[model samples]
Target: MTIEQMKRNARDKIINEIAFLAGGLTSACQVRAIICAYLYVDLVSDAEYREYCDLILQVENKRISQSDF
Candidate 1:
């Protein structure tokens, strides 16, 4: 997939898992770490991986409140 697509996929995956992620501690860090690690391997270079990480972090930090549910 393209870099933008990859970024979007990562963001979506994180958002989807956020609700079931368990106490916002384990999954927030663990899943993001796993995804970023995988992106590091899958991307062409560190730069792309870094961008993916940034994008993923932004997604992970998005505010979701009880009312949104």
Candidate 2:
């Protein structure tokens, strides 16, 4: 599949996982957790896009790891 397709799939998976987790819990913590998961997915998508661009640049450069950045 294409990069864009992969990104969409990843996002859908993240949302499904978050929904499952949220379904098991109650109160404000659930909302917080869902928000965090959403943000995490967004970051993942952004990082993927950045890396794609970096590759297109065709220059040797170090990019921060997702866990570290």
Candidate 3:
């Protein structure tokens, strides 16, 4: 695969795993925290980084359901 495709695949795999592990309310919060820690660096593009941050925010804020993943 191309470099960009590989990056997307990696991102998708991590996100999907996080979403899967967030099956309950408590686990959902934990997932948010884990994702925050995992993304502590500022290497990726602003928009790409914000997408994941926003997703966790929605989960933490109960604006979206974990099953939506």
Per-structure clash totals for the candidates: 0, 0, 0
Best by TM-score: 3
- Model number with the top lDDT: 3
Best to worst by lDDT, what's the order?
A: 3, 1, 2
Which candidate do you rate higher for lDDT, 1 or 3? Answer: 3
Off by over 4 Å in 3: 25-43, 63-69
The residue-by-residue lDDT of candidate 1 on 12-54, one tens digit each, is 6655654445335444566657666656656334665566456
Worst 10 residues of 1 by lDDT: 18-27
lDDT against the true structure, each candidate:
0.57, 0.45, 0.58
Q: Estimate each model's TM-score.
A: 0.38, 0.38, 0.48
Question: What is the number of residue pairs that collide in model 3?
Answer: 0
